[model samples]
Target: QEAKLWLPSAVPSVSRLTVCSVPVVETEIKLRQYRCFESLASLRHYLSLWTRIVLAQRAKPRSHHWSTRSQKAFSSVRERADDTAERYRRDRQAILELRGRGDWEQRLQVLRNEDVLSADPGLL
Candidate 1:
């Protein structure tokens, strides 16, 4: 079936080819050019087949093509998260150190008072 469909000589003469009883000149020209039994239908089928193959290959899980922009974005997000964690660690360490000091309570009281005065309109 496939072999017969692909053979140019299998197509009837131009005069005999018609679409809905109307003579199709362009289709006749294409049929003669390809020398195929069913020029338009065969070409359309082949095109669709190729398109599906390409799409399937692209959709495969392990066949991802990671672009540079996506890689850069991933690295940047990871770096930002690392930086935030490091900053938190450093801030926690400073607070722990301050808590261990002898005058920590006094300093804290003074800072609290200053903060309250700055935030309270009545104190000003």
Candidate 2:
């Protein structure tokens, strides 16, 4: 009788497996190459360059005219908002008027109850 042992010959290390299995596309490689910033100025320059490129792409003014229905809807919404604001202001003013009147009436009632002014008809 003979004892035999079978062992796997190719055992890939974690690092090697991860590195080889993932496909690195050209765009990713280019991005990785550009990611090295030696200083803050370099990073700022890179960002500004990209910003200018993006801005240049959108240099043309786009004409965006709203549809008639949309314009009407927006106008209605604005009118509704204005009306609500006006109503709020009017209600607030009315409430303040009522409060002022109530305070004035209370003071008048107190004065009348004390009969301080009634004693002197000249003060009335």
Which residue runs does candidate 1 get wrong by more than 4 Å?
Answer: 1-66, 101-124
lDDT of 1 at 92: 32
lDDT of 2 at 96: 33
Instruction: Please tell me which predicted candidate would have the highest lDDT against the true structure.
Output: 1
What are the per-residue Cα lDDT tens digits for candidate 1 across 6-116? Answer: 221223435333322323444433434333223323433433443443344456534245444444554454454344334433433333332334543343221222221
Root-mean-square deviation of every model: 36.3, 34.6
CA lDDT of each prediction against the hidden true structure: 0.36, 0.34
lDDT per residue for candidate 2 within 7-104, as digits (tens), equals 11122333433443333323332332233212223423433443443343356433454344444554454454344334433433333332334543
TM-scores, all candidates, are 0.29, 0.28
- Model 1 superposed RMSD (Cα): 36.3
